[model samples]
Target: MTSSNFPKAERLLRRPEFLQFNEGASKLHTQYFLVLLKRNEGTGTRVGFTASKKVGNAVVRNSIKRRLREFYRQNKSLFISADINIVAKKGADVLDFHQISTELAAAFGRLRKKYA
Candidate 1:
């Protein structure tokens, strides 16, 4: 799902960036994960992914992160101009791409209305 049009230049990188977003970010929840949206003055959109030990081991957590990144890359337009961090819960370890996309779409719709 890598896109030439969507470069990685705008993504959240440093640990501090994640912390800054996580501090008081507006949260949108779904059964699969929690979407934290932090509105900032930055242009375009940035994203991060996280899954705790409760979710799974290192491999499972990494899988969740990869899938979440692909999901975000595909449906990024639904998210407004802000920094985003998605925290996956235990259930995320078993969910397929379709289920993850479904839940995240709903959450994104709510966030769009909220941050609009």
Candidate 2:
């Protein structure tokens, strides 16, 4: 079985890595988030989450990030070998986990079909 862990190697933790998406990434917009995806030469997929001040205060932002990370961990197999950045929009702080997951799943499904 595939491990359901969110390891360091599967995360985009640096500024440069996140900024790389600005150059030529494909963007997918959902009601609560903006997903930027770019194919990478690496075999594994890496993802990053961003919650700006516009989204909410520290507590709210962290909660959003945590939820996003958990979703990614549980559904890692749904992703392709790419670098993905998920940015939370202003109203995203209001979404519950299931709402966030549904929107994200739809967004990733489109990505999968495009890349497949």
Candidate 3:
């Protein structure tokens, strides 16, 4: 079974990495998010979450990010070996965990079909 732990190696943590990844990524747009996907030759997938000030105040932004991280952590197997950046839309802070999960699942399903 795939481990549930979200290790540091599985995250995009720096500005340069995000910028470089964005340069070559293909985008997937959902109702409450914008997912940027780029294939990587690395052995594991890496993900990053972004919630700009436009989304809400610090509290709301962090909540959105936490929800995104939880969804990714629980569904890591659904992703391929790629660098993915999930950016929250303005109203995403309004979603509950289940709603976020449902939307993200559909987005990832499309991603899998495309990259599979």
Clashes of each: 0, 0, 0
Candidate 1, residue 11: CA error in Å? 1.8
lDDT tens per residue, model 3, 28-116: 99999999998888757999999999999999999999999999999988888999999999999999999999999999999999999
Q: Give candidates' CA RMSD values in order.
A: 2.1, 1.3, 1.5
lDDT (10s digit) by residue, model 1, range 1-116: 44523466667778898899647888877887888888888676888788999999999999999888878778877889998889998778999899889999888988888888
TM-score of each: 0.89, 0.96, 0.95
How many clashes (backbone atoms < 3 Å, residues ≥3 apart in a chain or on different chains) does model 3 have? Answer: 0
Give the per-residue Cα lDDT of candidate 1 at 69.
Answer: 81
Clashing pairs in 1: none
Clashing pairs in 2: none
